[model samples]
Target: MPHLHDDALTLLALGEAPTDEESAHLDLCPRCRADLGSFRRVVTAARQAGAEEPGTAAAADSDNPGLQSPGPDVWARIHRELNLDDALRNDPLASPNAFAADAFDPARPSPAAHAGTPQGNVRPLAAARHRRTGAWLAAAAAAVVVAGAGTWATLRAVDPVPGPEVVASAELSPLPAYSDTGSAVVDRLPDGRRELVVTSTGDDAQGYREVWLLAPDATSMVSLGTMEGTEAHFELPADLDLSRYPVVDVSDEPYDGDPAHSGDSILRGELDL
Candidate 1:
């Protein structure tokens, strides 16, 4: 079966049940399960942090009348130090784990200190300062994984994985009838199916151009279809034996109400496979 898409994986990671077909796929596919597990762990970590946070109501209900929220200067330093803007964008759940950046540093004299901050407020502020480091550290971890431990590990974690493995390639030289240059790349997908990626620098011709796999004898061919642009991806028909149809060909085709090859071959090459 083909792999699930990123959006589908994201939904599953958020604990939403997928469609019946997708649920069955998840149950059977190890790759998808691993990806879902990563998302779940991130969510759980965020929730745990939230539970540990001192309550806003508790702070409000305190007997100390002069206690104030940490100033803006404290937050600016934290954001700059940890790159929180980038982190929150990558992992929304990471916001819940955000630390109070205003950890009191005894070494640095705070403006609040010279303002004669009350002794009652000092202990709470000091404790908050200590927790700030842990908050940013947790956010960093969340962001790193969310960005996908680089492309390879990301592929290792999710569906549509690892790009296609190049199985064969061919460079097509223009025949006397045309001067265009082109190439063909054949790839083996993770599920063991093959794909043909055709690239060309030719101008769009009179009608549309078409692709084909020519027989070694040059007497038989399978029409892949009209080329839409300078590059296109086409799945090799499963039953078409590549051993017999090893030559890749491209021709200028016309809309003559016929599906047959135009017989006006412009570029051709033989595939190693």
Candidate 2:
């Protein structure tokens, strides 16, 4: 025969009455059976009053909230709200109850007596607990804000901007007679704006080449229209400062009016500053 305890009631409330072995134990233990029924009633009332749910199955999971899953200690609020002190202490699975005697009122300070306690000892442990609780709540809120900001930053970083798509082509001219000398130049204009000059001086290649402003890593490049041999000046937008656009490249263009680059790159250069 197995000994009966109050916790057997909670197991029964969770619908976990043992079928064969524990069933025989319950048959022999009238005390546990009666306690089990009371446990069911108390759990039902508690759920209806505040807890709202008993098992973890139907409760709100952090995954679907359009947010990252909270830390493992996120349920601290629920633990405090449920008043599980006695249950936590009596639990065999829980850590050993070192403060079994004081768990009820864990080292509260006497407001009237502050003279003997030095500043170090004068600190209230209960107040420290509440302070820690408040700090945790504040940290959780900050984490939520930071997580939201990080998500926004990632989306903004990946979003494509409206710009040209043509890049330089690498294939030499079909005719060997074509002598194309390509030089790409980057200059900071007087107005703090940037300018990219791609000059292709050649007998057969005296035409426009597609210009692109690439990120430092070369992972992304934005088109800046065609720079023909006849055109002397090409201006960068005032909104586009040097700090933002750091690299520039020049490529051969077919002038077919198709915006996308032909994937043939001849010359590429980045700005010095």
Candidate 3:
């Protein structure tokens, strides 16, 4: 059997009893069951957040403050920022007609016109309920969009923009026996922090790879870090002078716990700063 539609699931979440076929499908299909559960959770959360208890309408109205509508400027800003259509510039919660302008018609016959008929009273109530539900949903969706846009703007204002400058770069060539060739770049970030990005491609050696910064004379060196794949980023110490350690080297190291350069350099290059 086909899965239930989203509308059916939403109606179920809104407390409408499921039909026998729907119940049977829900019992058999795990995916539909999970979807229904998710919709139900959202409905429950919304109700808990905004719904007042039954029989407490008068007391609640007297004691608790009602939700305030956002200012016109809020909707205007949301419209400008989100580039929404001009038709949606108006706040949906400000008026019921905002979403369902034609929901009610003065020319249409009223339920009283067909008072003697069986469906006269029921039809009007059902239609009214449907319109109210649809209008509420539309307003709720618009409110969510506005809130999300506001949140995005707030986050964009607070988050820092990354500006990386390549202070030095090197073209890593295969040393002698190894066929791996790659490149390395030292980037200076906006916050005065430095990092080395390396990328290489070749046959996978038996041992793991290690990165290092070496002196021009190949006498002194410092291990930046280990490389697990073809690309990696290693943070450079603030105190480490790049001029003194201008050579970048990638080596294949064995599992031996020597903590020293294996001297088996796969690729090496001198940075041009």
Query: What does candidate 3's lDDT look like per residue over 180-233, in tens digits?
Result: 877787877669899898878764766889999999999999999899788889
State the weakest 10-residue window (summed lDDT) of model 2.
164-173
Residue pairs with backbone overlap in model 1: 103-129
TM-score on alpha carbons, each prediction: 0.43, 0.29, 0.42
Candidate 2 to truth, TM: 0.29
Candidate of highest TM-score: 1
Q: Rate the local accuracy (lDDT) of all candidates.
A: 0.58, 0.42, 0.64
lDDT of 2 by residue, 1-273 (tens): 345443333444635435465577655443344345455554454333322222121233565354333332333433344444332222221222322333213454433234455444544443332322333232222222222222223211222122221121111222233445443444453355545545554423334566677777767677787665533346667676544555655566676777776655544544444
In angstroms, the error of model 3 at 246 is: 0.4
Of 1 and 2, the candidate ranking higher by lDDT: 1
- How far does residue 134 in candidate 3 sit from its true spot (Å)? 52
Better model by TM-score: candidate 2 vs candidate 3: 3
Kindly give the number of clashing pairs for every candidate. 1, 6, 0
Q: Residue 59: error of model 3 in Å? A: 42
Who is ahead in TM-score, 1 or 2?
1
